[model samples]
Target chain A: MPREDQGPLLEFKAVNTYYGDLHVLKDVNYTIGRGEIVSLLGGNACGKSTTMKTIMGVVRPTRGSVTFDGQPIEKLATSERVKRGIAPVLEARRLFPRMTVYENLEMGAYTQKRGAQFDEDLERVYSLFPRVKERRNQVSGTLSGGEQQMVAIGRALMARPRLICMDEPSMGLSPLYVEQVFDIIQEINRQGTTIFMVEQNAAMALSIAHRAYVLQTGKVVLSGTAAELRENPAIKEAYLGELQVPAAA
Target chain B: MTAVDVYLQQAINGVSLGAMYALLALGFTLVYGILELINFAHFNVFMVGSFVGLGMLELLGVMPNDPALTGLTLVGVLLLTFAVTMVFSGALGVLIERVALRPLRNIRGPASMITTIGVSYVLFNIVLLGFGADAKNFPSPLPQVQFAIGGAVLRLREILIWVISIGLMGGLTYFVQFTKMGKAMRATAQDPDAARMMGVEVDRVIITAFFLGSALAGAGGLMFGLYYNITSYVIGFQAGLRAFTAAVLGGIGNVPGAMLGGIIIGLVEAFGSYWISAAWADVIIFSILVLVLVFKPAGLLGRIAPNKS
Candidate 1:
């Protein structure tokens, strides 16, 4: 549990998102405090990605409120949300493939005008991801999986966002690269950027997350501290592919 | 002129003609890139721009008395005409977008095209009613200035057309490649949703694209009046068709492709008229378009870039 001193950076209170009549997200609620890694874990079609989209204002909630930095932004447009410092690294690394790596980063800082802070943020991103610096001139599409992820992260960091939402950062990476991604996520969190990540890799997600939520069928089935969830029988059985407790089963 | 000299002179003529087409073609491509609309009204807007230039020239009045003074006055008037026509036409483009296209934003693709085609008719008729159907003799201020390079003899009008068109194209390229707003335009074209996520005001970018493109077409209209020394309301139909074809040939959404496509079409028309007959020139050009469509849908320089999500 985080200390009472630090306030929640993002809050989703009774957010119900729908795609026409599909009812994609059903009264979901979660909170991420400042300087914490909060992960949403679920299976295929379980609304993990929808949750991220709702945060970015790509999907408006039907009957709930989403407060970001204490402002109700449920009715705002995606571009307006972005200007408010809610940046997203969309599913499968949505870097502008036709653009150069450097150009992609510059685009991430679109809300900020050209000035000293823009340059400073760019330098900070380069220092955080040296591979991105070396491949700055290369087109984003040609980059390998791990390197592309670096560009995605570097691009998000360039915005100087209060919180960065990532979707499936480990979805298509090699085992070695997966470990590197998790380490980088922790490093990003350590540097005072709040993270709200959606993933299917529960073990990896829980390992670094300060607080974690396990969703099933568009609803939160389990939510607790990372340490508590790490030892929970339900998570181990459902996510880690372990034996269920006989009585509970 | 010898046989080679005739061909060389035709080539120079082709280049000047193609420069005007390039500007019109570039505008068409820019609109297509953002809105995915054919923008048939742009052709009529080109016609309006020519008329606007004529009106400015008339308003400025003809140079009187001293020959040297006439030269200076003509230069001043032409410059003023260029500035006024481009601004007037650019504003017209914005108006067309607001009145004819903006409300139809959610309409299916072909519906928008049909609407623009209707707008073209309305604008063409309006101009015809005002200016009358007869072709007006657009006066040339310069007194038959001529120069020769090897076998090819060139006129001052042709040289001026080339210089102005090339300068405009260069400026446009710089604006798109180096400026922030231009990047936003490309981003919006690629994926408007993703661009919105990146905090790009896609509507503004679309409007800017229209303004820039219409301005180029307006300048082309001015050049067309100067080079051909004639303006008719119906001229837009043929010119627009040719320029639209040029845009398709260069890859509808590609900037450089539109330019190259225009030049190629111009050259083909010129050479075809010389070698075959003036009546056969359009046939040859259409045949080339058919060939390009059949072989390479991406056009010469167009690389099919995947739309970002």
Candidate 2:
């Protein structure tokens, strides 16, 4: 994994956000480098999703700046941010319910305009989630939770984004699907696309993430390398509850 | 009138009336589908179209007695009314969007609904003050040609109603299915946030929806005036209510559904008036509404889904 000193891909400088004066995200400062899988770990209502949403321009920060590709994107609209290759798969896999799987994929490539490359993107999405191809004519609303997650991720990938933000991807998934989703995130990172993920499962998230940040009540309480966080006593007590030490052979 | 011939005549009249209702309902449904807001002021837009038709007829100097050039002049009046009403109603739709709907979109739903109702009342009173209480008779452009088909006599106005309504509906369907902008409108209707994220100018698409819907209502108004040969400020309320019911019956937001609902309601009214009793027309229509709601709450062609918790 690349060091944080190597210049980050996305930088949030003292960003603050609010939900109608509730002051949700407070002075959030974080960086995710290119080709890295960084996870934002926190319990519910800890501003983990808020951080991701702020970065995606869904929740505009009230103070400070967010820079993507070394340009300030704080004032840009969510769609403009998306066009700049920053895609987000929101929590709960909000797919267009009435649209067919193929149509849902086509909507993902909406920014690509009508061109030859649009077909190429569809092919790539189909290749990533072959089940989507099998059920191309099926409406997205009928898909299982795991399949919907796959469609959501695949849809984001179709945008040809340099960075993808995933919010609570493993919320209601079975353990096996959770592992599969994590593997896919790692594979996507291996393919050179950066990932900023918000996850409730701290152990699984830190296992794959190169770096991680722990948020509590709209503020970052902890930040370090994955190994350092895994070894931290406080993190173990707060997240893992009881540490499992391997027996001596 | 013979039993079979009267039945045929009523059916023809019902179908023609239903065609007009279908046109109006379609306009209402399109706007409702996209915006999820009831454009109550649309009724006045329709009435304004009739008034504009009256103005055009007067401009052409085709008095009620001048039967010499009346036929050609009536055609000019129809075209003129259609053009003027479309522009005027289109502008009114956009204005309402900008002034009332847009401002209140971010507000709560109830507030917006009440605001729209208020706007509707304001429009009604304004027209009443301008046009007064007397009903103005609209001069028909086409001669009242009636022909025998089987046992029933068909009126030219009735034929014109079908031709115009069906033609507009076909054109609209083609535009929505084939045009890029129409696709964008549908996309926006489905999911505004996602549509915006996909770089669709959501506001512009919304404005376009309003324009198209209002234009259709304007055309329907002109046709209604031509067929009924009467116009009044208060006429909009009855038409608007019936059209709203038609839209609801046709699945609220579905375009073709609105047309179907309109035609069904029209037939019900006509048949009820002819065979049952004219006084029971509304009761029959409302009964159908209750039946539709009880069985298919989503209306015809509406896809049912699990209710979101």
Candidate 3:
């Protein structure tokens, strides 16, 4: 891949991630340029989630490099990576169960010192998520799945992240909530924050994504502009469910 | 004194004793809350605190028969001793976490508990070597002043002990409830990986937990020495067991539970000593612990979670 005069905000150069003998992600390579909504699409167990985890340093890569702003961060701790402007809205929206929604947001700003800048980011998140403000005092565990998702995104935004990596934003939500979530994601991107997302629902993901990658097994099987990938015959048959395929492996 | 008066005195004594147990148990439970390990070395830290107090008192020459020492000067010395002991014990706790417990975190085993037991032995032996194995009388520096309250006679030391315990617990409660670091500790305890993803340094939280808990244990030990006038290296084993029992009684991981548990245990021992026999106090407390375990395993304040697959 030829580098633009300016490097990508995030890049995985031939990264191989494994859990013991189980090769979860193999020779994975992709880059998210600045201010891009880059979505990774795949079926369950196809390593879409693993790609997100590797970037977050929850799961380390066995080979190659993961660089953020051309700085290799594969060796960094998860919190260190997070401090370096990458916040994860993890799968299942893993909010602190007993903490209030406000406390959860506070935890998101743990890397940043408590000051004027912290207050500004917090106010911005509350404005972006008026519903979260409404449920500020409520415990996170008791929230509805959609509300929790809102909190998850709002919490990530509290980190003042340069690039927010989301693992399955549409995990257990109605079509209405999914649509609302994509709208918020687009809004966040428009505000100059880059997004890297993994989604099981390919059609909804591609609709908002500027660029997208299709993951199969441990490999990125397809990568292109969202419009180009959406028009690809294979993507229509496999992801968008627009065409029927012959019975095959 | 009448029988009712004696019982009232016993109850007061029990409450005071319970305060010390509550302090120790709070520290014990704090460690268990974050690391899920019994800090077996906590009592030793307490013992070291007692010695530290004894040494400070010796340096200040504030003994019971010291007529020349001013009350204000004695108070200053006492406060300085506490500061030194708590800080030292807190550092020791952080050291244990860094050198022993933190390294064992990645290993999939119950080795942390065993390592704590090892730490307990190491601390015990270190104290034994530094101070002789024989019991050293902790000279109560403050003048023996007793006052009657509600037909029960109480010493100045007794009242001061209760005040100090309440103050420490209150301060701890405020810190945990209102501070950012405290919130981070709670988040890390609930889910470390999630907390890290949210940019919390999990290691710092664990260190804080250990330091706070051990510092409390140290203060408890110094107070115990003052109250009982007995400071021996082996005292830690008995005190640690009782404190551990209190933590279990209240719910091992719950902070308020530990405090409640400690007080209850102290009250039980006090009443049992007065009503039954001093020898049977241990047996009575253990029986109560057995009953509580059989009935409420999550502990008195512990929340019961539904079964997880």
Candidate 4:
């Protein structure tokens, strides 16, 4: 939990994004406080990924403003936004597959100058994921799904970002990896980097998130603390049912 | 000359000829790797480089049939000409990308490609009007020196071609392999959207690709001039087709593939001309292109990428 004296670390005020003429995110509002783990929860095609894109400046919102740490960042370029300390762990663990694991981690700090600081960050990431260190010279594409996800998270950490935005971090992972990924996410948040994650896994997302927003068809239908949303029967019916389906079997 | 000597001489000629194609093919592959657009106008950039080199040489007081200067003076003039011509052609490439292709970036498909063909025509006419239709005598300052290796004659131009082209290729390889911008370029090629999320300046990378590719084309133009001692607007079309073929033969988007493809095309053309006739050389090269496309569409070094969209 962060002190209430300061403003939210990231704030999206009525942001609406479009792909061509098709509206993908409709007046979406979100607030993530400093050192907090905020999860954006939604089903497929519900604009969850678009929200992440908006944060990273991959997709610009036609209307509304996004502020980070008291600065308006809606008009900034993606690289400029990254220099302002925002980094993304893209969907499907979009690591540079052809590059070696070490190279991929090097790219994570693309916005920063290479020096002792880079070496320190690399050391830190290695400590967090020993497997990443062991596979440093191997090509990233050959890594298994779980390992790739670990590398992806390690790659984002290389940026030394103040806030890391992750999109569907658990997608395509085995159940065992899923729990491990969630544990890492929690551990990362505890280390003081704010996280804003988008997940289709409602049960898993709400389990570790401090606060969460539920989205459906480009709109935020509900927003509250994770504990409150977990007990909400409506959310359980809409999203948590995914976990329930397998459990019922 | 003995049969072995004849083959050795052709091999020498082929390698030198292939050096120019390798440079031009790199331009094509670099642009295609990033934009997936075949810059048909790139050949004309090479053409412009020839004229620009000629103009620079003239400005430096070197004229046709001048006493071929040797030693440091020749090297100095050559270096200056190469630098100026490359920068000129590189700027032209950036202009083409900025004015012609960048606007149509959002609206995908054949629009930008068709626009490149249009730009090619525009460049062709501009050069045609600027330097007449006749073949311009492009002079070289190098002393016409030749040495024999095992009964096969080799010239200074051939060695210089090999050295310079190999040097440029090696430099490009090092840059792409070790540099930060190079990593970003690779990342952009693999996945543009994902790269953007990483804070890569995607547009700047595209511009850099155009600049580097065009600059290489400029160098190729100068090499063609130095090798053949003549250049014209028609050369871009004739040689551009050959370079384009090299790019496709090597696997269109593969950098090293382009280099290998160019050399093979050069050797094939050399042998085809010697064994058959100069007129049939082009037919043989185009046939290789057709065969490669039909059998191994990915080229030798290219991998078949699954369609992302």
Candidate 5:
């Protein structure tokens, strides 16, 4: 494939990831352009989380390269990758339970030097999630599931990331929270941050994502505009839980 | 002297002894909090640190026969010896982690823990071979002043131990609670992978914990020598077990808990020695350890977590 005038912000070229002898991701290739929301859709054990981990440098690619901002960062540590502007809102909202809400946000900016800019970013996050500001002093472990999700997103935003990789943003959230969370995702993207999301909620993910990829058993089985995939019969049948029988059969 | 006054004096002695144990327990807790390794070699580190403090004092011209150095000069000499001993012990801790523990980090099971036992033996033999098996008298430079508060006598050496240990503990608390690196250490302790995601260097955090823990233990060693006026290669085993018991009593990973546990153990030992026989102190302490393990396995401050082990 020929390169565009402005290359993709993040790219995975034939990436293969493994956990010991168990092969998780095989020859996976995808790209997220700057300011675009890319959703990776998959079922259980389809390597969606592995893809996110590989991008964040938590899981290294055993074969192939992962490029971020046009730089090959295959061997970089997770902290180094964060320095290169990648921040992850990990699966299951792994907050430091003992720390207060404000402290959790402070930790998100650990890669950056402390100064005036931190307060500015903090205010930005606070403005985005007023609830997080209200309960800033409370221990994070004591927060409700929906409240914890808000803080988790607020924590990731404190990094001032150019590209945010959110793993299952809607997991364990109420319907009201899921809608609010997706709305916030769009708002975040509109303000100029590229998003690479791994989601099991195909319907909600496709609704906001500009481009999408369907992964199956460690391979990119389908890729197209979100609009096109939303209309595809195969996607609706498999992921959307809709039965599509051959009308002519 | 009434019975009340004697018990009061014993209580004061117990607090001073407890402060020293708290220092050692803090080291065990810091390293164990981050790595989940018992660091059995920390006992030897404390032993080595006492020897190093002795060496530093000798180099500074403080002799066994020399008159007690008073005023600012005594303060300066003590500070200098503490600084050198702490740095030496802290570096030794880092070296042990890098050499013995780091290699076994990725390997599952008790490889690193067993390695620590091996290291404890190596340091024990090194000290034995270098300094001989007999206990050496540790000379103190503080003036022999006795003061009484509410009919309880307190020595200058005991006062110094309390002051230095409390000061160091206060400093450790501030570092962990307020500073950026301290926050990283806490974050790493809570969830290392999440901390890594937030750009905290887990390796550096681990190193920092080891350094801080070992340095505190080093300070404790100096205090132990000053208070007991004795140093021996075999001292590490007994002291290490007591401190380890303190850590478990307070809650293994909890910082404030370790301090409390150390003090309690010290008090128990003191009271046991005074009330019962001196030989019964060890029996009582180990009995407390067994009772705590059986009843409150999570310790006085530790939360019950099914996943911790």
Candidate 6:
């Protein structure tokens, strides 16, 4: 559990979500501090994705409050939530397939007032994903998986979000691409953007996460600093499985 | 009739008819583009516009034989019908959305289609019951001025059809290409979920689309009444079906395609009816559709990639 004095940027107070009477997320609680990289680590069917969806307002919680920046966003519409600087890079890179990469980014800045600020935001997105700038006119659907993922992240960043909730950025990507994505995530966090990520790759996630929560069966089982969670025996046995050999040896 | 003169006359007539078809087809395409569901009740909205025009004429006490008041009365009736039909039909679109569509949100595609067809029949019967079965004659607003162009005759009605259709099309094109709201509509049509995430009120944008589309259909209906000088309960059904066919032929969800398809269909029908046989006009059009489908199913200007969910 995080200390009470840490002052969370986002706090979910016992969130309970249901999909037509089937309990999906049961009494889930967690917090991420401002400018922190926090990962919700879990295996499949463990409600990690559900937690992200709930925060993004894609799925509403039946019983709980999701407070972001001291404002409760539980009842706000998904679009309205987006306008308030809360953006989510959904799993599977949910891009507007027919639209070009640049158009997709412009869409992200849809909520922003139409002016010079919007143009500056587009430039920032292009700068962050230089590959996207190279292929600005390419249709998002035709792009490679890694490139598409970059477009998704770039699109979200166009909103100039206070917090970005990413759902499995490493999924379906090659190892090199995975590492690149992680580096970008770290770079973004270093630039003072708080990130809440849901990842099955616990080892990599824990390495960068300032704080982390291990979720099991719709509930949080453990919470601690990155180093503490890395050393935890339960995570090692279930997620890490085996250690790599030293290069010198 | 001399071959060249007959051809020229037919071409002029086809152009006028094409303009009206394009106007109506735009409504069909715009609605279908935004919402995947086909609004069968759109036809009834067109029929309602005719009724509104008739009501306006009656209120103004314009008679078919009264030449003095006919011109002024026509303008008044057209404006009154346009305003009333737009608002009323737009409300009908909203009502259909809320009552018919909202409840069936979870229902799959085929079922929604059948439900819309059922709604269309219900609207047809209601209009039939309200208005008598007889076809009512509408008084013409303009003096039937005819001009000879290259040995072919052209009427004032034909000229009005071209001017109105082109003017409206240009206005709509400008609106869609330049306006902020139009951009929002296009974005929503492309991706509803992404549009919502962009802070676009998807439902409101859809409502605006419906209002604009239905209003256009209403305008077409008033023009149809003026040109044909008759209105009937079942008139919208045939016209609606043709407009829908035009929409499909041009590419179901493409706005510009609808216009192109409508004009093509009009020209085909006119040429077929004049040269071959009136009985085979529809058959020829449908055959053309089959050929288009087999060769290029996406229609003339359709996007190559399928829309992402």
Tens digits of per-residue lDDT, candidate 1, B171-271, equal 99999877888888877776666677788877898889889989888898888887888889998888888899899999998899999999988898899
CA lDDT, candidate 4, residue B131: 76
Candidate 5, fnat value?
Answer: 0.89
Task: Look at candidate 2 and give me any clashing residue pairs.
Answer: none
Put down candidate 6 lDDT per residue, A130-230, tens digits, no spaces: 99999899978799999999999998888889899999998899988988899999998898899999998888788789989998988899999988987
Docking class of 6: medium
DockQ of candidate 6 compared with the true complex:
0.56
Tens digit of lDDT per residue, candidate 1, span A1-249?
333445677888998988988998888998888888999988999999889888887788998898877778899877788887888887788777677898888889988878999999988888888889999999888999899888888888877898999999987999788889899999988988999999888878887899999889999989999889878888887886654222443
lDDT of 3 by residue, B41-97 (tens): 787787777787777777777663355344778678878878887898789889888
| Candidate 3 collision pairs | none
* Over 4 Å off, model 1: A1-6, A242-249, B63-72
**lDDT of model 6 at residue A92?**
80
What is the C-alpha local distance difference test score of each model?
0.85, 0.80, 0.86, 0.90, 0.90, 0.81
Give the residue spans of candidate 4 off by over 4 A: A1-5, A242-249, B306-309
lDDT of 5 at B145: 99
Candidate ordering by DockQ (highest first): 5, 4, 3, 1, 6, 2
TM-score for each of the candidates = 0.93, 0.89, 0.94, 0.96, 0.97, 0.88
- Would you list the rank order by lDDT, best first? 5, 4, 3, 1, 6, 2
**Model 4, B140-171: lDDT tens per residue?**
77798999987899999999899989998998
DockQ of each: 0.61, 0.39, 0.64, 0.67, 0.74, 0.56
True contacts kept of each: 0.57, 0.41, 0.87, 0.65, 0.89, 0.72
Between 3 and 6, whose DockQ is larger?
3
Task: Score chain A of each prediction against the true chain A by TM-score and list the results.
Answer: 0.93, 0.92, 0.94, 0.95, 0.94, 0.93
Cα displacement (Å) at residue B193, model 5: 0.6
Off by over 4 Å in 3: A1-5, A242-249, B2-4, B63-70, B306-309
Model 4 clash number? 0
